[model samples]
Target chain A: MSVKLEFNDETLLCKLNGEIDHHTTLPIRLDIDERIESCRPQTVVLDFSNVTFMDSSGIGLVMGRYKVLNELGGTLEVTGLSDNSYKVMRLAGLDRIANIKKGGSKNGNQ
Target chain B: MVINEFKMTVDSRSVNESFTRATVSAFASQLDPTVEEINDIKTAVSEAVTNCIVHGYKNSVGRIYIGVKIHNDGMVIITIRDRGCGIADIKKAREPLFTTLGGDRAGLGFSVMESFMDKISVRSTINKGTTITLYKKISGRAK
Candidate 1:
């Protein structure tokens, strides 16, 4: 998986591409956390437009990030999730912890 | 009635999760499952394989055996087995949000598999290994 970060004021837009599974979660989590700690964004928006596949590992990635941002008094949002990806998120009950939008800008502002 | 059967043994590595999913999905393609059904199978297979890699081998690099059986009635059966440190408490392991790793793992692997598949059974022996069997009935919408 590859993650591109965009800073929008206090929101850190994370555009994720490829598959998010066990093989990719570790590096993805480290990279995202590193940026979150350095930037301290008020909101972290994960863009899943390009993510073709995700498993339970993706749920852990999102939940782990939620905890990190929550501890900082911030929040996380997910947008542009494909049908399958969104279903996985919902099945894992991630929508309860993070704001889920059907589609939005890469920056997650829309 | 069995239509086809496929089996493979792969290293218990995170990268092989995708391979496991792909291989199962390809075999299920003959039944012409819908996109949602295909996704469900992929997700279920991923959870099983991930369990073998994470909890079974504990990153020690072992081998996981995967078996797929396709039924004439559009049913698919998948079995994943790993010869690693087996689960001491099978009941607790299947619980959602229960994880021994206690880090990035959500412990939702079994739950996801249960939700996606029609039936699931888990058998394990401490210091022996674990075997997970999943069954799904496809709608067979292929034209």
Candidate 2:
């Protein structure tokens, strides 16, 4: 499924669920963009607690969102990433660009 | 979807990369697999075919055979078979950062496949052939 979006005054939280492959990203791209545009929150947090898989498409999705939010003078943060997903983000050098919180619990248990 | 089954054999070539991905993605769509599952299967197949062309055939002339089977439950099993120089060390090839012929390769193909698919297995023989099988459990929702 595409990632779910919930927004507060300062934060737009994306509850990412399921695999992040090529087929699934388009919906997310549209959903998140529309939500962010309407809410225009100061901080966007991507919660990957339920994501089980990812690939290059996932990287592209994240990068595209970051660019969009950055242009609007907004900030982006990623939390609750599984270890494997975290590694993929690191490989793409996203750690330097976004705020990635590292203390999230491991996968499968939660 | 009637569980479409397909078999194809093509010469070792790079230009067919996009075509292969498209075909597989289209077939996978029957499962009503989420966009993520579709993309994962495409990426994994692309990587496997690329590996066959590069490492299996050593960038030389050879043939790669692909077989796809779809189940009613929306699971897909793809097997890539190639008769080329087989993997000397399957374990080493699976390492995240290890590459026998290094360049732009992040050595993440196996990892990506493993992460995307529900199961994967590689069988090879020295100077014989290599076969990589991938299984993806897809959702029943019709796309």
Candidate 3:
């Protein structure tokens, strides 16, 4: 899996692609955690629209991100998750912690 | 006639190695498995080897014992064994999304194994080791 980072003054958007299995998680975790610390944006959003497949590893990644952002006093949001991704997220109870937006809205903030 | 069998050793770093797995899975594709079945087998194999590397040896240098046997009854059996930290609670570990190593694991390995294979069994102890056996029948399935 590959993760693309988009940074602005207010948000740090993470666009993840490919399968989120064990092989791809460690590097992604370290990289994103470092970015979050350095950038320290107001909000962190993960766009899963492009993700083709995901399993529990992906859920753990999202939970880890939420914990990190919450500690930083910044909120976390998820947008454009595929149906399968959404199912896994909900099953893992991530839909409660992270705001899972349905549409492809650029400004996820209400 | 004796059926074909294959064996390989996989390290944690090489657990993501898909080429060999793809080849093996392709050979077994003649069974005409459903899409979910194929994905489950692949995921289970990946998780088992990963567990050997991550949880079994705790990322230390170790080898995963893997054997693929085609039974005369037209059944495919894949076994992965690790001589590392054995599981304390196989039942708890098998629970979906229940990982002992925090983010170090996804806790879906056993679940995926059960989902993909026709039968899955695990035997382990505290320090001796752990063995995961997966079985799938190769008959009456469509490609």
Q: What DockQ number belongs to candidate 2? A: 0.06
TM-score of chain A of each: 0.92, 0.90, 0.91
lDDT of each residue in A1-110, candidate 3, tens digit only: 78989899779988877777776778988988999999998999888877766656777788888889888999998888765566556766777888996547465532
Better model by lDDT, 1 or 2?
1
Q: Is the docking of candidate 3 incorrect, acceptable, medium or high quality?
A: acceptable
Query: Which residue segments of model 3 deviate by more than 4 Å?
Result: A49-53, A79-90, A100-110, B1-5, B14-24, B69-76, B103-106, B115-118, B136-143
DockQ scores of the candidates: 0.83, 0.06, 0.31
lDDT, model 2: 0.77
Candidate 2: clashing pairs of residues: A21-B36, A22-B39, A23-B35, A24-B35, A24-B36
**Where does candidate 2 stray beyond 4 Å?**
A1-110, B141-143
Model 1, residue B40: what's the lDDT?
A: 93
Given candidate 2, what's the lDDT at residue A68? 85
TM-score of chain A of 3: 0.91
lDDT of 3 by residue, B1-143 (tens): 22768787766565443543455566556566665556556656766777777788885767778888776666778888888999998889988877877654556667666765789999998877899998887664422
Model 1 misplaced regions, further than 4 Å = A104-110, B141-143
User: What is the two-chain DockQ of model 3?
Assistant: 0.31
Residues B1-143, model 2: lDDT tens digits = 43679888888776565567678778778667776677678778876887887788885979999899987767789999999999999999887656676433446678777877899999999999899999988875533
For model 2, report the TM-score of its A chain: 0.90
Q: In every candidate, what fraction of the native interface contacts is reproduced?
A: 0.83, 0.03, 0.22
